[model samples]
Target: MSATEYARAVAFGHAFARRQAVRTVDVPGGFAVLDDEFDQVHDLNRLIGTGPVTAGELIAAADTVFGTAGLAYRQLTMDGPTGTELVAGLTDAGYRADRELLMAYHGGELPEGVPVSVVEPATLLDPAERAWRAEAPGLADGTYRQLARQRLRRPAELTRRLAVLGADGTPRAWCELYLSPDDRVAQIEDLLTLPAYRGHGYGSALVAAGVAQARTAGCDLTFLRVEADDGPVGLYRRLGFEPLGEARQFHRAAGGT
Candidate 1:
């Protein structure tokens, strides 16, 4: 990763945690984000940051935090050398690992398809269930719903909740655009479109809307994060996004997946 890309990723993650976590506790390497009320919402409750610490020490610190908070699972994502090096140790200790990519706009702009409007996260729930479950069929119904609903906990004004609604007023596609122009970055997160409605290009339209809006807001760069192997990477590339860097995620499910 270039220093610029790496720094952007780290800065966004740190800023996001500080603003969203119910409570953040200091620990070796970085900090533990705790939010018992969210029922293990990984983004709101996980270990973040990377300095230097053994996998054993990292796991111990994370477990202590979750245990004290009565959380049933644990998640940690580190986008640095310390995290990259801990992959083997974490997997050996039975944690599931995921590789994620940080991408930035390079040039592909989609043709305008649909108009998107600001809306509450809940407004997209019906279509989201159809879209997300098809993309991540492995997650249980309740888990997927909970994951999507996690955004609702935040103040509605935090991010621009953009969506393309169906004829009946339900959103057919949705996403969140968080503009932090002072940081010179605008993050477009969690893009989803209903399964049956996808071929019509709702996904690309959402991306276009976000990119145009973010740039209009004076953000120097627009970025998105997703698992390295996710299918949407192709679509995003078609819309001008290219790989910036990588991040590693180590997680243990409630019953230890």
Candidate 2:
């Protein structure tokens, strides 16, 4: 697929991730998901799309939704002209921009001998919750449980979750793959290796399993997004993934309730 199409596919996958949230709304050029229960930027508030909406209009729309939700911060994905103007407008409005690389991997053979397994999204919840809590004990509260529950309800054919298990059958690493309906593109998302399992090839194994599943499902291209400073570029490259472009996220800190 061409670069622009690839980027859009990745964006679609992200929007699809929050399908269970009740507050997503369509705006002038795109859509937004607004919530007050979760601290995650994407979960609490997010604007998606890259159409030709004015900065003023975009800000006004975001303010309406975020204000009503009593949320001060909103994250936006930068894409087309509308994205550019929103970034400038949001900056002037006291928001900060964070950039990340969007990467893609065309289908190919995965490495051998790396054990990976595909599990139901529901099956991932218990172990994932435990792992997450182990890493961030402070966040092991009701809100986190609620978010985890929401994530377990996968959006129909559009998404799939894969995992690599430890000897005891606990998830060591996992990732989600989203396939476009036409089967032309897929996106690998939320790839994570538990802190205790990092560097044991579980991450690589999970990724390979995701790609293989996408290919078997008839997708020719796959994509993912990674933080600019998280430092996994080399790992993805070694797995035959390459940079397509960057997606910028703009965040506005929470304000008055």
Candidate 3:
């Protein structure tokens, strides 16, 4: 498998553990179980733990679970060479498909800030700072306070801090540096900038700040993801991050539209 593919798999496995607070167990026969409230079996490149062996078996079992709980499940994709039979099985079974991109960085020192001081994200949750983050383009979906509260409710099992680009009382950008329990690695999450503030270098500064913070926290490496077609790929590459892996994202709505 390619390095990119390998990195992507590791990233997903890392994120999956965070999102579900579960562990990926190494079962027999080159397979593993992502044991959440609903256990899923998959191989390296990712196939549902349908039967004991393949996607087909897993889907057959999934029907009952999804029906009974009204739960929507998705195929757990992995990285590297997976058998075509598994893809065919999922397609034949009507599983939805989508794609995601992964990136990683190593071997570079984060540039030191000359004018601005890198501070902890928790500081920004203060009322005025929260207002600034809420108005920030990337965080427009919700308030910074709301998101912080939601995150704090969880066991900080591997939660990253929310860092913002600020001078005086205003924030120019925002990003999160978090940890993954399964891999014990730090990762960049929720990197965002206000659309109007894009050209000033705040994005780079924010990422650098995140990396520096993670390193200070004793993390060995950092990871982040971006859309394959997005322009940030170039920016990230320039910052020493490279393609690590690829993934598929599947989503379905209540209305099924």
Identify the candidate with maximal TM-score.
Answer: 1
* Global lDDT scores for all candidate models: 0.78, 0.71, 0.52
Across 1-257, the per-residue lDDT of candidate 3 in tens digits comes to 34744554465554554454333333222223233333221211132231234655545544443334344443354343345675666666666555556777765655555233444545445633454565554743334445443433223555555544455645556665666434546777666666666777777877787676667777666777677664488888888887766654332222322
- Clash numbers, per candidate: 2, 0, 9
Query: What shift in Å separates residue 45 of candidate 3 from its native position after superposition?
Result: 21
Candidate 3 error regions (>4 Å) = 1-68, 72-85, 88-96, 109-150, 165-170, 180-184, 255-257
**TM-score of each model, paired residue for residue:** 0.89, 0.83, 0.60
The alpha-carbon deviation from the true structure for residue 195 of candidate 1, after best TM-score superposition, in angstroms, is 1.0
TM-score of 1: 0.89
lDDT of 2 by residue, 1-257 (tens): 55676556655655564564556788887788765556453544677655777667767877877777766666677653225666787788877777778778854555767787877888778766776677567853774575555555456667777888878877878888777747477778778888877877888887888787778878777777888776598888888887777766777766711
Cα RMSD, model 2: 3.1
Error (Å) of candidate 1 at residue 76 is: 0.7
Q: How well is each residue in 1-257 modelled by candidate 1, as lDDT tens digits?
A: 45686678568768876787779899888898776667646888888856777888888888898889888788887875544458888887779998888888877646684778888767766666666677678877677777767777654445888998877788877888888767777888888777667788888888888989988889777888878875577877888889888877889888667
Per-residue error for 37 in candidate 3, Å, reads: 14
Task: Between candidates 1 and 2, name the one with more favorable TM-score.
Answer: 1
Task: Return the clash pairs for model 3, or none.
Answer: 4-244, 8-244, 8-245, 50-57, 50-58, 51-57, 51-58, 160-177, 160-178
* Winner by TM-score between candidate 3 and candidate 2: 2
Write the candidate numbers in order of decreasing lDDT.
1, 2, 3
| Candidate with better lDDT, 1 vs 2 | 1
> Which candidate leads in lDDT?
1
